[model samples]
Target chain A: MKDRPLILVTNDDGITAPGLRALIEVMNELGDVFVVAPDSPQSGTGHAITSNATIYCTAITIDEGDQIEYSSSGTPVDCVKLAVNEILNRKPDICVSGINHGSNSSINVIYSGTMSAAVEAGIEGIPAIGFSLLDYDWEANFEATKKYVKKITQKVLDHGLPEGVVLNVNFPKLKEKDIKGIRICRQAKAYWEEDFDKRTNPNGKQYYWLSGKFVNKDKGQDTDEWALANGYVSLVPVMFDLTAHHAIQKLNSLGFNEK
Target chain B: MKDRPLILVTNDDGITAPGLRALIEVMNELGDVFVVAPDSPQSGTGHAITSNATIYCTAITIDEGDQIEYSSSGTPVDCVKLAVNEILNRKPDICVSGINHGSNSSINVIYSGTMSAAVEAGIEGIPAIGFSLLDYDWEANFEATKKYVKKITQKVLDHGLPEGVVLNVNFPKLKEKDIKGIRICRQAKAYWEEDFDKRTNPNGKQYYWLSGKFVNKDKGQDTDEWALANGYVSLVPVMFDLTAHHAIQKLNSLGFNEK
Candidate 1:
């Protein structure tokens, strides 16, 4: 018999997070799962990798699952890199990240450690997906989203993803019956309005804590924000290419070489 | 007279990097400049922001210039946030990051701390640009690229950039005479072939050091990779929108809700 598909699992909420455990439970039904994730929470880390410091990875047993788990002292992206390069015996058929406690929608994808792991895997030519829930609470209910997760994962394995793309799947925080359905949508044009809390340090020096309010400026009904707001799971096929193809012509008209 | 454009300058290279200095010099001629960058090098930080730890920021006078400079204990994105939310008296007219020590071309844009700062600025409704040199050296010459930098910065000031978009400008590492001018291009379909050096730690732990070779798969002459190869500066207008607009239709066909 052919071996079950090798599925690599990871998340930014750390290996011990409840969200990671939920993801593991879902993936176990699909394939031979190998998990490599950060030992501590790495939310908002984006695509950071450890360059200035040495990365430490260790094999660990997280639960009673058949899947093997490894914990690492690195960012979410680093975890994927280490897993694909050092831990995994062969290239995995798929890489799945998160089922995160918080949303990785719209601009959050750019700041998400969960999605970064998936994006990194996609860069390595592995089909990957990042899943998140709309609830930010640590005790958010994920049981309701498990069916959709399994369905999506199975479908991806049945028909592979396109090159240079990964899925950013965000589920609305509601009862399964309340979820209207899934909508494949564009990342909404949204941003965080930063508000740094300024204070004095013990040494009489000034310091600041980073804080922000999410602002969605785009009024488009076809955006991820709209889908999530209307009780639908949002799936955005995300690409790492940052080039703005539309603006290139305008830049050429600037006469960059004119003396 | 209208107030000088408040231009915020920053880089992934530490505050003392030659590239940052060159950027400051260029912005000095254009507007009121504020330098808020990392105290140490923050290369490849992507869009990371400090959350688990306290951020320490202090004002420091680097040289005899009218521009204000401050060093921060944060990543490139944090520097931009701190500058806009705390340090700067007003929202800067533009935010320019990195005349970087190395290129942030093609897929490197995703892992770039330089571009993250620019992306952060763009998210905040400030026109942004990230500048880089093809040569990855501490003392790479940037003198010849000054004129082009001025021209582009001026055009951006005059025309303004589209919302949620920023420029990723990469200069070819050649003398002005040999340079073929500039090309507006898309991010080349390129990636790093990860080569991790696995070793055992003194504590009997397995560790990995990240290393890679850049592999450009796209041969299109209209790509940033080709532009850099042909001795032309590449201007790729980058957007934070990670959504694959074309995939929406394909995903819609999946019937995700059909149980």
Candidate 2:
């Protein structure tokens, strides 16, 4: 690693979000931080990129900080792409996304814009991490998360992540003193049971709001859901290669390859 | 399976797209088809949901077919969710997305709206497949794709997909007579070498268009890239579990679990 590493910062909660501001503060203590994030909130925009629209990234100053920042007219993934390919003259030593207001544990990772940024960075061969808290309120306290966030980032910087892998770090809604140490975990077999909020407008037009209750069926203690429930900050090693390697042989036996 | 199976059809290219119409035509032959697709083109919208926007799905008739259709003001993933939860009264026998006007063979799966719908269906515990052709033209002939599409769908109907797995099938741009049979394959280690088209607007401001060249370095014949290049249909079984199972032990040994 360089004497002073270049750190790329981003979040789905937009550039002016309090969560991102808190992230920038801690990242400043670690390295030369440069934030390239979305101009507007982009929650649930998983792995999306701006191909149809013209991308515009402009330099912005939200607060007094040592870190430089740019707001882009795109999704969280687009910010990461812009950071890696256009904004940063050289490759960053590490990329960190979100001190997110909501949890991205278990099945929520598939719908998370925060983790999508981290995944995009990993796809570009950079060590990356996505951090989130259990609380979903805009006024949620971030004081406790900073301590462990710094610790986890330092640990990753000290020991580089594995090839094609990134970390999805999620915290329980607890005080710093109440929080347990970092715990390595797996993504639990969990899902959202959708119950859309169906409503009719004044014009008699029907619309729906996507709402769901998270259902965790896995009873394994070695999962992110369990760790967070037990007051420990869960760290799941995430990979982008979506191939179900175990099923390949079974598929071969199904006779598609033959004739 | 039911004698007349209830099939859920969807695509990222919108309800008016010829690719989707082609998909509906094939699905109608196999079962009772229901299409819930985007109202506009949503090519690069990978796994995105419409949580931030008011989702509107209105019943519409696109063409003459023994199928029902709904045009949704949402992304591809949202279409699948709506189909599974609200639009369809019962569980679908299988969810099929696309006859997409472009390739979703390798790394493009991460950015593909077509594959995202299939992945969403798989997440919802439905057997699903995404079909795409190598050609990018809007009016690309899907005539060559229908025969193999029917055969593969019938095969999948006969033998269901493994739990938590979905198929990503891509066809080479070829005539029906010139096309080869299906080849079960793995996702290739391929990526886009991004080169942004930096430009200046009439207002003297700078903007960028995200453009990139597809780069494939993997020489393995068992991969999707190799199969497509060799005039065969590539079918890669994809999973949504982002866990890097192999790296869990490595991360443990690196001592994140240690106090």
Error of 1 at A192 (Å): 1.0
Evaluated with DockQ, which candidate comes out highest?
Answer: 2
TM-scores, all models, native as reference: 0.97, 0.98
DockQ of each candidate, alpha-carbon based? 0.76, 0.77
Candidate 1 error regions (>4 Å) = none
In candidate 1, what are the lDDT values of residues A1-259, reduced to their tens digit? Answer: 1479999999999999888999999999999999999999999899998877888888999889988998999899998988887778799999999989898999999989999999999989999999999988888889889999999998889878877789999999999989888888899988888888888988798788888798987899988999999999998999887777777777777666566
lDDT (Cα, tens digit) per residue for candidate 1, span B106-213: 999999999999999998889999999887889889997888888889889988887668999999888888878778899998888778888898878777888878
lDDT of 2 by residue, B1-259 (tens): 4688888999888888888999899998999999999999999999899887799999999899999989999999999998898878899989999989899998889889999999999999999999999988999999999988888888888899999999999999998777778888889988887888889999988898998888999999999999999899999999998999899998888876445
Q: Using lDDT as the measure, which candidate wins? A: 2
- The TM-score of the first chain in every model comes to 0.97, 0.98
lDDT of 2 by residue, A124-191 (tens): 88999999999999888999999888888888899999998999999999998998888899999999
Clashing pairs in 2: none
**Which pairs clash in model 1?**
A244-B237
